[model samples]
Target: MSEENKLSVLVVGGGGVGTIVAVNLEAGGHAKVTLVLRSNFSKVSRDGFSIRSVDHGNLNGWRPHEVVDQVPAIGFGKPGFDTVVCCTKNIQDSTPSIEELIRPAVTPGYTTVVLIQNGLNIELPLVAQFPQNVILSGVSFMGSHEPEPGIIEHDFEDKLVVGAFRNPGTSAALSNARARDFVGHYSAGGKTVCEYTADANRSRWEKLVYNATMNPICAILRTDTATLRLSDSIENLVRPAMEEIRAAASANGYNLDASIAQRMIDMDPMEIFFKPSMCMDALKGNLIEFENLVGEPLRAGKKHGVAMPVLTVIYDMCKMLQWQLKAAREGRSQEDMLKVYDSGKP
Candidate 1:
C-alpha cells in the first residue's frame, strides 16, 4: 500500500494502557487514531481519559477522535484502518467482543493486528481465525492504572517488544517496518520499544515465565510486586515455579537467562512496588484470565514432561478461587475464595 493509502490505526480497549498508546501515538503526530472501548467504558470517551505519572508528571485532558463500545459491525466505514492494536485482557473464553472487532480488520491485504496482552494464548486463536501473516505479538513492561473513570496514572518506564510468530513467512518486511514505526513512536513519548526475535513463542513463554511466578502470587497474597520480591516465603515459592517454567522453556528449545529475576529485582524500589494487573482485576471482582496465564503453562509443562509442582498448586488454588467467585456471582458463597486470598497472606 502507498503512504497515502495506508489507513489509520484503531486501538481496542480504552483502559490505562490503551489510553497511553493512543495518546502517545497522537502526540507523535499519528492523527488518525480511533479507540474502540467496551460499552461500559464509553463514558470515558465523553468525559475523556486522564493520565498522571511520576515520570511524565501528569497527562490529562486528552480526547480520542472516535470512541465506540463495539467495532463498526457494519464494516469499517469508508477509510478502513491499516492496523488494529488489541490491548485487551488474555482470558480466552471471555473475549468474544475482542474477536469480533479483530475479524474484519484482518482481511489479507489490509490491517495488521498487534496484541499487547499479558499472556501467550491470544495469538493462536487469532491466527486460526485470520491469517498468521497479519498477526503481531507485543509485550510491554509499562506500569499504569485507572484511579477512576477517565483517569489513568502512569507509574513506571517500560520497554516494549514486538515481533511475529515463527515460520509463517508472511510479509516479514511489513511486520518489521511496522514494529520499527511503533517503537519509534513509543520512544518519542519517552517509552522504550524494540524488535524481539521472530520466535514469538519463546519470547512469549519467557514473559509467561515471569508472570506465572509473579502475578498470581501477588494476587493471592494481595501484595505489591516489590513486597513479593522482598519476602522469603514468596521468593521460596516463586523460585520453584520459575524453575518449572525454565524447564518448560528448555523443553520447548528456548534457553532462558539465569539472571532474569535478579535483574527484575534489581530495578528501582518504586518500579518494584507496581502491582500486577490481576490483583487489580480480583479487587474489582472481574473474572481472571486463569486459563491463559496459569493453566496454559501448566498444560504445556505437563506436555513437555516438566514438573511444575508449585505452579500446579498455585493454579489449583487460583482455579478454586475463580470458581468460588463465579459461584458467588451466581448466588453462592464467596467465603472459600476470600479465605484463599487471606490464608496465603502475601
Candidate 2:
C-alpha cells in the first residue's frame, strides 16, 4: 500500500507481543507500524528486533516503519494514528493509566484503541475516557517472551479474538467495521489467526478461566505450567479460583458454563513445558500483573456478593508477592515495609 493510502498504526508496549504485532502488520504490507518502546528503546532503535519463533521463523533486524520512544501528539497538523494497539501489562488504577499513557496519540473521534492485554473488564477506564473512539477488546492467547533486550521467543499459539470492548457505546455498524479492519491488519500474515466477536467480554470471561487462575497461581508458585498442573495447586487452588471467576462473570450477566474451566485446563497438554507471562515476570524480579488478573475480579465478586473465597486468598498472596517485589527492587527490607504499614500510609 502507498503512504497516502495505508493506515497509520501506533503500537505501544514493544515487548514480546507488541513486537510480534508490529512485525506481522509491517510484513503484511498493509499499515504503517510505529512502535513505542520503554526500557529497551536505545538498543531496539539502533539494531531493531531479533525474533526466534515457532511461527515466523528467525526474524533478524526486523524494524517497523517508525520506532518512537515517546508517543507523538495526535493533532496540530501532524498525522495522528489510525489505531493504537496497547499490549502492555495492565495494573489496575496505576499511576499514569494505560488510557493516559496512550492518550496523546489518540485522535479523539478518529483513532481506534485496541487493548491486547490480559484482564477482566479492563476497558472500563478507556471507555469512560474516550467515549468517541472505538475501543476494541483484543483477547490474545499467544505466548511470546522477551528475555533480554530486542530478543523475542514465541512458542505458543498466535491467536486473537477481536471485537467491541463493552456495551453499545459506538454504533454497532462502526464497531464491527473497525474490529474487522483491525482483524484484517492483524491476520494478514497467514502465520497468525484472528477472529471477530460481537461480545468480546464473553471471550475475556472465558479466557479468565486461564488468566485468573493458572496465570496468578503459577506466578505465586514461581513454577511452570507442567509443574502447576501436576501439583496439588491445580485441584486445590486453580479450579476453585476459576469457579469463582465463573460465578462472578455470571453474576455480571456473562454466563459461562461449569465445564469451561475444566476444558481450559485440559486444552494445553502436560508435556509441553512453558512458563506463563506472570511466572516469568516473578522469576525475573519484575512486577507481575496481579491486580488486573486477580484483584479486579475479586472486587467484582464482592460487589455482586459472589462467593470468591478461593480467589480472595489468591489475591492476598499475590498482593504480598507484588509488594515484596517492589520492596526488593528498591532495596528495602520487610521491616521497612512494616514502617510504611505502621505509619498508616499507603
Candidate 3:
C-alpha cells in the first residue's frame, strides 16, 4: 500500500498510553489518528483529548478527526486507518469484548494490528482472529496515564520495540520493514520510535522481567518506581522475583542474560515517578492483569522445572490484594486484609 493510501490510524484504548500515542501521532502531523473509546466514554467527543507530557512539554489541547465508542459497522469505511493500535489491559474476561471492537478495523490488505500492552499472551489470540493480515506486537517503556476523561499525563519517555511474534524469523522481513517505515515517519514528525530486536519473544520477555519485578511490589506497597529502586528491602524482594522471571524466560527457550535484569534494576531511579499501570489499576479498584504478567510466567517456569518461590509468593499476595481491593470497592469489608498489610502482621 502506498504511503498516501495508508489510513491515519485508530487507537482503541483511551487511557494514559493510548491517549499519549494518539496525541504523539497527531502532533507528529499524522492527521488521520482516530481514538476509539469505550461506548461508556461517549463523553469524549470529537474535541479529542488534552494531554500533558513531561517530556513533550505540553499538549494542553488536542483533538482527533473522530472519536467513536464502537467500531463503525461499515468496517474501515471512510476514514479507514492504516494501523489499529490496541492498548487495552490484559484481562481475560474482557477479551471477547475487545475482540469484537477490533474486528471492524481488520480489513484485509489495508490495516495492521499493533498491540502495545503488557504481557505476552495477547499475540496468539489476536493472530487467530486476523491471520492473513500483519499482526504486530510491541513493548513500550513509556509511562502514561489519564488523570481524567479526555486528559492524559505522560510521565516517562522511553523507546518502543515492535515486531511479529508468530514467526519470529520472518518478523524482520514481514513487519520490520513496515515498522521501520512507520517509525521513520513518526520520528520525522518528532516522535521517538525505534526498531529493536526482530525477536518478539525476547523483547516481550525482557519487558516481562522488568514488569514482574517492579509492578507487583510497587502495587502492594503503594509506591513508585523510585521507591522500589532505592529501598534495600524492596530490592531484596525484587531481586529474587526478577531472578525467577529470568529463570522462566531461560526455560522457555529465551536466553535472557543475567545482566539484563541487573541493567533494568540499575537504571537511574529518579527519572520517572509514575507508578506501574498495574498499581494504578489496583488503586482504581479495577482488576489487575496478574495472570498474564505474573501467573503465566510462573506457570511457564514450573512447566520447565524452574523454581520461582519469590514470584509465587508475590503472585499470591497480589491476587489476594486484588480480591480485597475489589471487595472494598464494592462496599465489602476488607478490614481483615488491611490489618495484615497495615500492621505488618502478614
lDDT of 3 by residue, 1-346 (tens): 3446535788888887877777666666644677778732655674556777865767655666667777654453464567888888887555465657788776655577788887867776666666666767778888777777777778778467877657332344667666665665455456575565567778888988878768888888888778777778545888788888998998899988878877877654566665787788888777788877888888889999998999988889988987776677667556866776799954
Ten residues in a row with the worst lDDT in model 2? Answer: 164-173
lDDT of 2 by residue, 1-346 (tens): 7878888999999998998888778777788989999899999999989998777889899889889998878777898888999989986546678889999999888899999988876888898889888999899888788989999988786899999875356777898889999899888777789999988888988888788888888888877778877878778888888889999998888999879988888767688766778888888888888787888778887899998888888889988998888778789977877888889965
TM-score, prediction 3: 0.84
- Highest TM-score against the true fold, candidate: 2
Looking at model 3, residue 69 earns an lDDT score of 79
Candidate structures ordered by TM-score, highest first:
2, 1, 3
- Count clashing residue pairs per candidate: 0, 0, 0
Q: Looking at candidate 3, what is the lDDT of residue 213?
A: 69
Deviation (Å) of 94 in candidate 3: 2.3
How high is the lDDT of residue 113 in model 1? 80
- Every model's TM-score: 0.85, 0.94, 0.84
Which regions of candidate 1 are displaced past 4 Å? 1-7, 39-42, 54-57, 74-77, 95-97, 167-174, 185-192, 266-273, 331-346
lDDT-wise, the better of 1 and 3 is 3
Candidate 3, number of clashes: 0
Candidate 1 similarity to native, TM-score? 0.85
**1-346 per-residue lDDT for model 1 (tens digits):** 3336334778887777887777766665644567887743656766777678544556656676677777754254565676788987876456475666577655555667888887756677676666544677778777777777678877766556777643153577777776666666555555444556567677778787768877787777777777876678546887778778888778878888987656554443645575677777777777777777888878877898998889998898888777755675666546865786799996
The Cα local distance difference test for each model comes to 0.70, 0.85, 0.73
Candidate rank order under lDDT: 2, 3, 1
